[model samples]
Target: MKNTLKISLKAGEKIYVNGAVIRVDRKISLEFLNDVQFLLQQHVLQPEDARTPLRQLYFIVQVMLMGQAGEGMEKTRQLFRDTLANLLSTFRNERIRAELKHIDTLVGQGKVYEALKAIRALYPIEEQIFNKDSLQEEQVFAKAVGE
Candidate 1:
């Protein structure tokens, strides 16, 4: 509110600001002298990437931000919490659990950008978890065949 923020965008790059999508024709820099809600291009997640539990959570949060909290926002929020709850049960690592909790709090406060950042930070950890689960499943199958 009191401080200003500056953003630079490259040609063909897009930014979603307060529910509006803006694309730069060329390299441009914008300065916001007041509070604003915006997301950069790299941070945006494609719908197809929502296959994972945490990614699904991120998609729901993105919809809430872009939809301007219109009708169904609450339902979307419910989905977010539900997704988080499911992930919490599946991921027992304290670090992952703590990140999920922090994301929930950020989203509750309408800080979608921060929530997305938090989720992105956990992506590598999630990948590791998924790989481990796959390896375990393969081992189980191998044991069954050997028996």
Candidate 2:
């Protein structure tokens, strides 16, 4: 049996369901009793906002979710896998690296939404790693100048 899903939306909120975007002008509650694919507006990333490599992947998956799965699904899936492979190759953090496998599983099962969430959660770690690298470089540069 499919567990029912209840979603409450405020005015002007949007939800993408099965590749269709629906916006409510007023407060509303919705329930889905069957299998449904839906994404909240807050999680939606615009094209320009996808500046980071991970975010770019998110945007591409979002396009597939946005109803482009007809003619370009194979292409999208290939790209997602390729990008994920590259990430796995270079990611230094064990936590993030481990998640790549789970994310791949989700994407392979057509659970792109869950895959996106897993990737999104890794962003803070990615930023922290980048910041640490920058700080280390600055320290090294300062040490060389002082020597």
Candidate 3:
């Protein structure tokens, strides 16, 4: 079975896919594009499914880091980073709330690595919204304590 997907490109161009890209002359809605991209990044398209594109991306990164460089790996990494940044910007409130909850959970369990991973993930977007020095201080202290 073949599945069709629609993606909007920058400059109001719409691309359709039946597993292959086809250009459409009509202008695409940026809001629609943003919504689709956000949903993909958040793994919301199949909320009950075990496998998702985001999970696939994470697995791809892990596999790439293991051995042999694959074609377009750098582009894949950049796409993941850009998608994550976009999601962070578009869902700032929800993302921040989720981050705080994760932080509390990690701290309670004494899982410094997981907490640091979460912080680093948010650092790109949260740097402007949060106090960097204080976060770094806490991270350093956690490291010093063998966490």
lDDT of each: 0.87, 0.85, 0.43
Q: What lDDT tens digits, residue by residue, belong to model 1 across residues 31-84?
A: 999777888888888998788887888888888777656558888888888888
User: Which residue pairs overlap in candidate 1's backbone?
Assistant: none
Candidate 2 TM-score versus the reference: 0.91
lDDT by residue for model 2 over 103-126, one digit each (tens)?
A: 888877878788878879988988
Overall local distance difference test of candidate 2: 0.85
- When 1 and 2 are scored with lDDT, the better candidate is 1
Clashes of each: 0, 0, 0
Which tens-of-lDDT digit does each residue in 1-147 have in candidate 3?
A: 344446454443433221223344564543332212121222212224414333333333332232223566566556545544554455546775587466446634634334435644654555444456578888999999995
TM-score of each: 0.90, 0.91, 0.25
